[model samples]
Target: MTTGVTGRLGGIARHARPRGPIETLAEVSVSVESGLASDFRGAVKPGGRGRRQVSLIEAGDWAAAMAETGHSLPWWHRRANLLVEGLDLPKTPGTRLRIGQVVLEITQECDPCSRMEEVAEGLKAALTPDWRGGALARVIAGGVIAVGDTIEIIEG
Candidate 1:
């Protein structure tokens, strides 16, 4: 038995340079070799080592985190590659997410780092609990991913 595709890509964003501002995108190319095309992370850390090709954040969880901390910042402030909705992001490594034509494997929790504090005061603390921050994943099978694309979870 397998779960069906139940989530959608709520949003997409890219950070061109390290610590640079995020640019929202309608669609982007994905590859097992180079995560999201033109994204700085893949370029800076080429090769699929350490499972950091792409990052995903649960839209609902983000909203909760913001509401809890009274932070009204944009979703891109988290600097993740994809904003997912309608499905609980699996925190466990080995989980696979199929987004449109692309596929990603959950490598680890994209834990809230000190960078979250830079984005908003107390945000780091807010994301510390409940896996609010997001999930870090590596591109397993690659293709084009866009906003509104369907997302499927394949348990590992």
Candidate 2:
């Protein structure tokens, strides 16, 4: 139950294919059936359980991790789908967040992988604690979303 708090969608990015370069976007369409447009992970599974459809990171958390690792890098290097600011993302699953017309359900923590180290030495370790790596979410309601969109907890 998040109350009296709101966040902003600071940025949006999606990779065309697995391990592909992340493309920064000003706006994009999202769908429960396809997740984010042009994203490699957009396709829904057979059971419609696409928990990792959208990966979100807190801007402050990203900054904290970078400060810890002492490696200055863009947030895209983390390869997250969305950068949310002005609100602290909850660690608990089932927390619902809304960005523009889209509603996302937090499914789990998006664990950091070796790719982070490839992007920056020590990055993986820096993002390891306290859900710094961000959260994995499934799109429950889909629509157009854009940079500067409001991100708010829709349900506890």
Candidate 3:
């Protein structure tokens, strides 16, 4: 059942640096409607209530990088379970992803906020304008997602 985007089980090795090709097929557990969900509340335009929700990045290093800067909150604040190596979640806004049986549509970039500043020192300054990290998506189809599940780019 392995395809270009979907594959079998994979291991996730922690990286000392935030940006780099770390590993492939690293499993990221996804949970619905969390802190990321709350942050997403402000990102959506008015009358876009159903368009906001946050899913956890499985092996995210963005949170890890923030931790290195002495931000403990950001370290534990990862809504994503796995931080993938090659995929840029934020860059693919409007794309569709299929993880296990769940289907998600990337809506917008998940920008860092003042709350991130409280977690990692100067994170607000770093993430401003460019928003160089993860993103927010809405679940079009709900299903259980776990580690080792396959992620497929159904539409781009």
Candidate 4:
């Protein structure tokens, strides 16, 4: 049997282009073709185009990284599409998750990119260990997802 984990979607963020400033959102529309409405990466990249159609992070992990780095930047600075709390994001690929009306399949680890260094020195390294950086996923069944939406593993 596939084990499951439960959590809540804590935050959402998007931007128009690479390295662009993130815009926080209370709700977002998702689709197989467009992962998150209006988000540059989502609109531009179609499903199966890449494993990183959407990205997610754990709120507690972000906090831990902040405490370790001694910097208090906003969660959007992490550049993930979703921030979740209450469950540890599975590190293995192929994990399936349900967030509100949407279902997503974990494709790979959303490894810390060099851009993290620009946000704050040592931020990249701080997020490098323990799956603190979260995971990249692709939308399987899409719909509207809102802040405070329940998150749970459908399969893992």
Q: For every model in order, what is the number of clashing pairs?
A: 0, 0, 14, 0
Residues 1-156, candidate 4, lDDT per residue (tens digit)?
256678999999999789887899999999988789978777434234557789999999999999999999988899999999998888888889999899998988888989899899999999999889989998889999999999999997
What are the C-alpha RMSDs, in order, of all predicted structures? 1.9, 1.0, 9.1, 1.7
Question: Comparing candidate 1 with candidate 2, which one achieves the higher lDDT?
Answer: 2
Candidate 3 C-alpha lDDT tens digits along 77-149: 4333233434445456677777677777777766665665654577665454443445567767655555466
* Candidate 2 local lDDT, residue 96: 92
- Structural similarity to truth (TM-score) of each candidate: 0.93, 0.96, 0.57, 0.94
Off by over 4 Å in 1: 43-50
RMSD of 1: 1.9
Query: Model 3, poorest ten-residue lDDT window?
Result: 8-17
Candidate 1 lDDT, tens digit per residue, 1-88?
A: 2457488999999887889989999999988777798887754253328487788899998898899889888898999989999988
Question: What is the lDDT ranking, best to worst?
Answer: 2, 4, 1, 3
Candidate 4 C-alpha RMSD relative to the actual structure: 1.7
Q: What is the RMSD of candidate 3?
A: 9.1
Model 4 off-target regions past 4 Å?
A: 44-48
**In candidate 1, which residue pairs get closer than 3 Å at backbone N, Cα or C atoms, i.e. clash?**
none
Q: What TM-score does model 2 achieve against the real structure?
A: 0.96
Better of 1 and 3 by TM-score: 1
Weakest 10 consecutive residues of candidate 2 by summed lDDT: 1-10
The C-alpha stretches of model 2 lying farther than 4 A from their native spots are none
Best by TM-score: 2
